[model samples]
Target: MTRSPATPLPPPKARRRLRETAALTQTQLATRVGVTPGIVRAWESGRTTPRGRKREAYARLLKTLAEEEAARQAKQKQQEQQEQQEQQEHQKPDEKQESAPAPVPKLEPESKPEPQSDAKPAPEPEPEPRPESAPVALTPAQAFDALYAFSAPALVRQTFLLTGRREQARESVERAFQAAWERWPEVARDRDPVGWVRATAYEYALSPWQRFRPRHRHPEPPPADPGDRTLLNTLLRLPPRHRRTLVLYDGVGLDLPETAAETEASTPATANRLLHAREAVAGRLPALADPQVLHRRLTELASNERLRAAEPPAVRRGGERRARLRTRAAIAFTVALIGTTALTARTAPTHYEPPVSPGQAVRGVPHRVAPGALSDEELELRQKLRDQMQDGPERLLPRLE
Candidate 1:
């Protein structure tokens, strides 16, 4: 018997979208497919692919989800069309009456103009000159400055919401813009330059390392309003991931997919975080159960605080300075490395020298003896001299001899 081919799955993003639309967590899908949640995550993230039976099960599940989503969207579209038709029907009579042509004025006979030779025609006003129609192209620096000006203030406010510290918020926005300026080509070509900067700012603002900084160790003063303070406290209490998801989705008015993409998380995971974040906030302040209310509260909280961003020229100059410092440091390091290498090559030994072998004792060798103890004759002679030393003159004459 021949084996049938395995079923194919959709792309990673689509797979994730399908799972999220079906409201299935990675674990839940993993359980049905007899695999680990990590495996399911990997599949959705495009790190791995399923095969054989698991592939078939996953494919079937996704196919069902896709069909359901399609049907739901179609139904939604049909409902929208019906609403439009109803609106048109209701507007038809008014539109017809408005479209009716105006009544022609009565044709009265005109009287001849009474000629007054002295009456001068009113002086015709000269037309104002029109300005140039073409748009002015911006230099790279000017373009970056414009982007920074347009996005920096609001981004600072948003970063403040992300991180409760005003100083860090401003710093984060400045650093993000600096980075954008450094990569202006890539940023300019991006479909959403604002989004690129916003993502960078959010990442920096929400960085885990920020918590370790001594300056950020202490929380900034809370908003004066009790409601605003409560809302902000609740937001800060949330995990960073959930807080960011909540901010992007509810506070910044991003859709689920956009938030997911920005946060670099799967759609289902993003939804889960958003749900948990909402629950946490709602649990604290029941009044914020509505997303619109939460968004308004977020806006009010951000606006209540005074956060200002650096000037665009200052930011651009700072970026350039940083880039120059890095380049110089790299060059210095390379020069030092090359110098060390050259020195080593120049001073290194040109040839190998044989090592001296250690000496060993011979088996038959004897230790050398000291000079024989004072000779017997020398001792006798010394005794004789001591005995015969009668006269000093004789001793002196013998010494002369």
Candidate 2:
């Protein structure tokens, strides 16, 4: 049988006590009690209290904390007054001592008139000061929306640069947003929430997704080539180290020193990796001769990957098969055309086969020799090319064949 979800237990007195003892605000107290502040007000008003044995605990806890806070405030106020009074007394004594001699004692005193009045007794002394806590504030909805917009994209970019993984960047942004929701006041106080999120996202990117996963993979920065659709593809193929180096150097457009700091590598190592990375790219790179083109390509790769994540392993394998088929088809077509052309060139007949002289006549056609064919050089030229024919299927093979 399916178990019905248990009815949530009403807030007990003990929870209220915890809130009271913590001296938390309604919202803060509600958070600790796991109930809304409205519920707290209901309990305090005696309209409803937690039921069962837990009720006793809540009542005792809240009552004790309330009493304690009352006593604490009373004590503190009393102390302040006492200190002020004492200071006055001391000052008065000093002034009197400096101006005149000792106090004069009265020789005789007579009662004048009795005044009727009711005077209250002095209040008790206050307790010691409670440690001060930082103030907590709630964020406005508009503030939260602005924060999310600023932080999300910045985090997304940082995560990409740090882990060379877009998915991780997305997850990092989500986690940061959740964190911001819980402690929005703190986020609001930051000078640059976007920068904070970006930094946090990069830290998140460095963490392993799962304990069992490899730790060796480090993310690279994006490339600079704007027109290059295959920029991301090149990154996907690079070793993790090279990827990280390239990403810091190119994706973020960091200088060598900054790249080294970002990657936690020495400047020399960073410089070396960058050098090799450029060389590697240049070796296979075409369309990358211009710096503008390279920048466009890199930008395109980062933007595209940010939009399209990698396929699942199974789907990727299927795609690989299709790619292989296309490659093979292209190779076979190229080879067939080359071999057929060679055979045709060897078998074709030429007009100069009988070594026709300039202004000579053939059986049915007038022959015009090429310019340098006459002289003793004719024999040399004949040997050099006795037969060469115009291009056509007819020259390729005899009609009988």
Candidate 3:
């Protein structure tokens, strides 16, 4: 069997983003990836993609470079800040001397206060001995119930931000919860079930199936408070991965590593995405560029009732049945296809030969016969030719005598 030709990898943005996130110049990336700078440019331009192991090497190297670059930047920033602090201290000797700690005043000779006889202070109530019984471990069902109640709204909100559609957000969140419910036995023991659910919901929200779904009859987006609309618009405008990372990082309050886990990306990549996302948001809302200012804004965005997964699921408790049906249908279809193909092959012939009529020449073939073989017309013509040849010599000789 002939193999299908290998197609190029997807999304020119992937290689470009990696290169940018790695903080590598084109020439540097080329040298590191063992390609010419022109080839790297072509990869970024979508004119070509690295094939086979080179593609894997490219991805691995980019991640490695990004981590290294992040470390370098952190070290550099720390050194610069330390040097600046030292310079400021050295430059301000007079100010430092002038700002010396004030001297403590000597205590006055001790004078004891007299107790008031009329006002007896009420005895402080003895602290109740807290019950020391180890807290009861919750059953998985109870744990899931609590998790679902507490995290569902925020999960739905983050998912809505990622997907930009409330209906899809609700669906994704519901699916995530349903999956959690099925796996509750194990998830109850998880360190962060809420994170697990939120991450799962994000994945569901980004499902490719969502792209093919009908968009008609969407519930209208409630009017956003104009105060937050600018941030909302900026978030929505970002690429899905970046937008999802931002929501998980700032909006969901996950730190870089936690956000990376949620986004199924490395910490460095998540940080890079978060940086770009913050910059995009800061471009629109300059106040958010500062860490203090952005923290306050993100706090408001995180708790904004408007961002709450306010809408309840349209339906619940049906996914399992639907999943089973889909599974069975897929198996049946595969079996049927295989059976039909096998049966047809068994019934087919190895080769084909169609009947031909006499005197009809094959399309591209000339008719030929053995020399001894002749038709009646050919025989009669040959005999006449022989008789003429035999009579010719005697008739001519008599005429001459």
TM-score per candidate, in order? Answer: 0.59, 0.32, 0.51
Over 282-309, each residue of candidate 3 has an lDDT whose tens digit, in order, gives 8888878875676566556545745444
Q: Over the full model, what C-alpha lDDT does candidate 2 score relative to the true structure?
A: 0.57
Q: Candidate 1: which stretches are off by over 4 Å?
A: 1-132, 350-401
Top candidate (TM-score):
1
Taking the tens digit of each residue's C-alpha lDDT, what string does model 1 give over 1-401?
A: 99887786786668887888888887898898899877887676443468888898889988999999999999999999999999989877654434668899999999999999999999999999998799988999999988888889999999888888889999999998888888888678665788888888888888889878899657677788888788888998999999999988988898987787677676778999999999999998999899899899898898998888889999999999999999999999999999999999999999999999997878899866886777899999889999885675543334553
RMSD of each: 19.0, 32.2, 14.4
Clashing pairs in 3: none
Residue 69 in model 3: lDDT: 70
Per-residue lDDT of candidate 2, residues 53-96 (tens digit) = 44545555566666777798899999999999999888774443
Q: Is candidate 1 or candidate 2 better by lDDT?
A: 1
**In candidate 3, how many Å is residue 182 off?**
4.2
Q: Which one wins on lDDT? A: 1
Global lDDT of each model?
0.86, 0.57, 0.69
